[model samples]
Target chain A: MSDKRNSETLPLAWIMPGALLLLWQASSSLGWLSANILPAPLSVLASAWTLTLDGTLPHNLGVSAARAVAGLLIGGGIGFGLGLLTGLSRISERLLDPTLQMVRNVPHLALIPMVIIWFGIEEEARLFLVALGVFFPIYLNTLHGIRNVDPQLIEMGRVYGMSPRRLFRRVILPGALPSILVGLRYALGIMWLTLIVAETIAAKSGIGHMAMNAREFMRTDIVVLSILIYALLGKLADSATKALERRFLRWNPAYRR
Target chain B: MSKNNGAALTLSQVTKRFGDTPVLHGIDLSIAPGSFVAIIGKSGCGKSTLLRVILGLEPASGGSVASDSDAAHARLIFQEPRLLPWASVAANVAVGLGERGDGPDGAAAARQALADVGLTGKADDWPSTLSGGQRQRVALARALVSNPTLLALDEPLGALDALTRIEMQSLLENVWQAQGFTALLVTHDVGEAVALADRVLLIDAGRVTLDQPIYLPRPRRRGDPAFAALEGAILERLLDASVSAGSR
Candidate 1:
């Protein structure tokens, strides 16, 4: 019965997007909309198809994906390590927390000029930008998760004579996982946003670069297609994280359903 | 279930203080191995503090807290189940085994512990899915699975309904009998102290004022004449201590 309900509701989700697409197509065909301002959905798809055939779209997309993944790994590793350090140790928190807080307050994107000057208008600059943007949310959320683990459970773990390593593996890590995952999901969003801004401003390759090149030639179709691709990528990232959350946190009461 | 003979716990002038305020004042007691001892007191009378000192969770301000040098280990059960919501009941039970739990035998021992608690079929269930009574039972299974020589219960059934509390008391008694672990229970209930403990100690104003032994046979009922008499004597001591405290 629930499956039937889900099937019925699934089509409803498409209705609004479908209607908008129909309106876009009608306006373009009727000349009610200028082609340069916004290309029809069908024209964007056709251009995207052509780009796919020529391998330009796929190649740029692959470059952007690699950059995003690399930045996430670097930033996530640093954030998780520092978070554990600060969360578990007062000494570490005292030594490192204030510096991180001060840096976190500075808008990461604003550092783009400095980054470009230091690293040049190369892939390094974009990767650095993405990594900086992805770092803090994960750090803060992980710290919050670790700090919030119930003291009672920790006491029980100690009373049971658990060694420090076992205590962390069995108790602290699992307790902090839900919050860490939340941070990761948030970081994924910042990851794409940072990459887009970085690539659009300065890059020879990638989806953002593709869109910027399209603007120079007034190929609005490709521009619209690129934007749609980003939207699709963001949606895909979100769904992937949600799947991960379900798999890892099935033991959590809130996630059981 | 190993029957350890003679004193399992030795407290020599064990005193605990939070800064200047002393919670346990020169507490000296000896608990025999494989015996059940309950400490009873009003809230803030330091019964819980004594248990914490005995379990080595808290340091004594003065004096020493020692157990049998050869005792295998000690485990504590709190009023709350304190189960990890992110772990299954079986996994939570396995936690009691300490480092031994990370091995393959942990799962098998957890299964057996769950069976001992009469929760054989619910090993895979989440703690959230279990009722309050059932959760406490799981806590028991977790504590018992380690096969500790000493079990420290700090108001382990304080949150249960009267009926569930009575049932749990029996369950605790039977486990204590079978496991032959040194059981030290701290509670506020007079009847419960008399019902489950082989010896009862009353704490008041940071001291043990009364230490009485109960020689009643097993399956002691709350309504039995001997049970009521023992309960009344402890209650009278508590009342006398409070009266003296109030006047002082």
Candidate 2:
């Protein structure tokens, strides 16, 4: 019965997408659905091919990728430093936590207008938006990771006469790594989302800009292709992050299993 | 060096209390170096507290503890293995050495320590994958890796099952004989105390009431008459304390 169920479900997963494509092709051929609003899947694939052949896809992808990477590094670095400080020191936590909480409560997207006013609709403004989006999750998780380290392990380190630096490096950091990785994964996703949003509003060239330009020209095929590309990029980023997480947390029971 | 060969722990007029309730009354005791001292007491008698104070993990309200302070690198084996769940068996054992930066050489030392505990084959295994007994063996290897002057044990085998506990007791004996470090074990089991220690100290109401030497030879069996007699005598002292507490 289980094998039968598995065999039935296996085809259903493939069939759903196949049936949708067939319906889309039939509707477009019969002129039931207008190409202006929803272009046929074949047309979207053709536009994707044209964009790739003309190097437009690679250029836009490179711009977005570079921006995302830079923003992640800057934001992740600051978040990790501040999070470790606040987590390890009670005084630092008392001094910074309330102010950070209040600031973090404000939606980062809401600050785009102010950011544009300050830095203009330049690269700086877009980078700032991506960084802001990346910061919160990494900071929160790093702090959680540090705070959750076992007190017994700390005592063991002390008893062994470990210097403060050695204790942090050998015991505290490894103990907190699993949570920090979780934060990194979360922050990466938000970084991409914020990057696209920022690019869509003001950027001259990027996937998001491409989608916007396609919409203006009523090139629904290009827009659909760009959306598909964005989805693929997000999935690729997530899978890479997962691979890194597994590599680092190999000793963790959950990862081992 | 000769004077340091016997167990010597000196606690001068120690009095400990938690809030208004006194746990250990004014107490003074000196143990010779190299002596295997087992402290046995009923729950709430402050035996564990006494061990903690000796280890400098806790402070006594009144009294000073003077040991060979230069021998500051004492190792403790807890009731639970307390192995770091995130570290492999080898890495956990090597934690005592801190970050030596010697790489393969330091790893070899860790391997040797695990081998001493008969865990060489399981060096790369995580603590979670190991059985309760194996985890305790890993903990024992961790403690031994430091070559500590003082080995403090707080019911280290109290959680093991009967068969495993006995096996661990033998392992402890073998390791103790091989290393010859001064050991202070806290236990509620009178039989365990008699079986393991050169001398047993019975604490009742936070005060040492009995300090008896066990002259029984090494490799003493639990079923032996000498071991049974010592166990009975410790049991009697514990019962006498309870009876006195009731009369009070």
Candidate 3:
């Protein structure tokens, strides 16, 4: 059924996006919208080319990518660890879950002003913002995954005289992996968005900084180019994570395709 | 061999109650070593509960149940395969050995067990890819790998289609003959009970209402008079219980 649907819809996926791009170009050429505020696709391409040749595009991209990756690693690690603890140990859940829930309810983005004030608009502030954004989704999903594992499987393990550590390692961890992977993917996307926002507000150089600087000079072409780069980066990160997920969860039914 | 002294299992005055209702009321039974015993009854007759008690999965409400064998004396094969979705076929089978790092010989033992179930080639395959019959075979292999002294099957073939059910029945008998482990099977299928068991124990409302020996020979034909007679007797007992319940 999925095969038939994929084959039937394959052409439309390409054609729809192509048609949208053509319509945007036509509108801009016909002056339906001002090119100053919304640059033509060609103008954006030209600005992107110029920026690439000058090495500024690559430099800013590297800065943004590094910050996002760093934040994801730290935040995802901490979240996964804590999530496992809360999911497996009732004591840990009772001790930490209420406080975490209260803190999670407060939007991490709302702490931007305080974070900047505390960390002084440096790399620390930007990274911390990205980490904070990535943390909650991963943590919550991990906890959910661990909690939802089949009780039957756990009983089977116990009947086999499996040690507590072995039961957790062999059954609980693998059972929770799919959910944990979902959390990781969600956290990575949020990490990128948060980094962009943070860099736009305070960074000296990064894709977000480039977009902000272009806005200041009314270089709408550069702004559009930077936004395109952001979109592409987000797609690339998502695809990479999906590839890793496939490798790890090859036995999963969802990953069969 | 002094076979008379080898008591396989004994459940003495096993009384189980749930809340205010009694399930197994002072039930007592003794199984000899290397015997195939079938417990047949209608649903909610507490046959499955008896198997669970024997497996140590559930505690008895009253009286004591004991196995002459060691702690790893018996293993259960549930109606569903219940294979771990994430583990490979070999890993699932090896899980029977618990968490004792069985060194390098573990893989070989797992493979041998799978071979016993005619699934040697599919060792690395995941449970998701397996058919219903294949999954049940893996479950059987998992139970067998432990070399259990007593095998408790809780309607293990109940979920299979007719053709698959017959095939699994034959495979189970073959495995049982080869291993020679004492088995207590709880099944709703009367023909299955007569085919596999040397003795049939019929339970109703958690008590053993009937204990009859099956004198049918090995390689018993389903169409034979003796097989049909046993099947009819068990069916009549079950229907009688249902009718009694209805009349009440």
lDDT of all predictions = 0.90, 0.86, 0.87
Tens digits of lDDT, candidate 1, B1-248: 43443338889999899998878889999888788999998888999988888877788899997877443477789999999888899999998887687688999999999998889899888888999999999999998897878888999999999999999999999888888888899999989889999999999999989999999999998888988988898898888888888788
Would you list the clashing residue pairs of candidate 3? Answer: none
Query: What residue runs in model 2 are displaced by over 4 Å at the alpha carbon?
Result: A1-15, B1-7, B16-23, B100-103, B239-248
Question: Clashing pairs in model 1?
Answer: none
TM-score of each: 0.96, 0.91, 0.89
lDDT of 3: 0.87
Candidate 2 docking classification:
medium
Q: Among these predicted structures, which one has the highest lDDT?
A: 1
User: On residues B1-248, what C-alpha lDDT tens digit does candidate 3 reach at each position?
Assistant: 01122228888999888899888889888888889999998898888888888777889989988888876757888888989988899988988877542555778888989998999799999999999999999999998887888888989999999999999999999888888889889999989999999999988777788898998889888999878987998899988987775676
Model 1, native contacts kept: 0.89
Sorting all predicted structures by TM-score, with the top scorer first, yields 1, 2, 3
Q: In candidate 1, residue A55 scores what lDDT?
A: 99
Can you give the DockQ of every candidate in the order shown?
A: 0.78, 0.55, 0.63
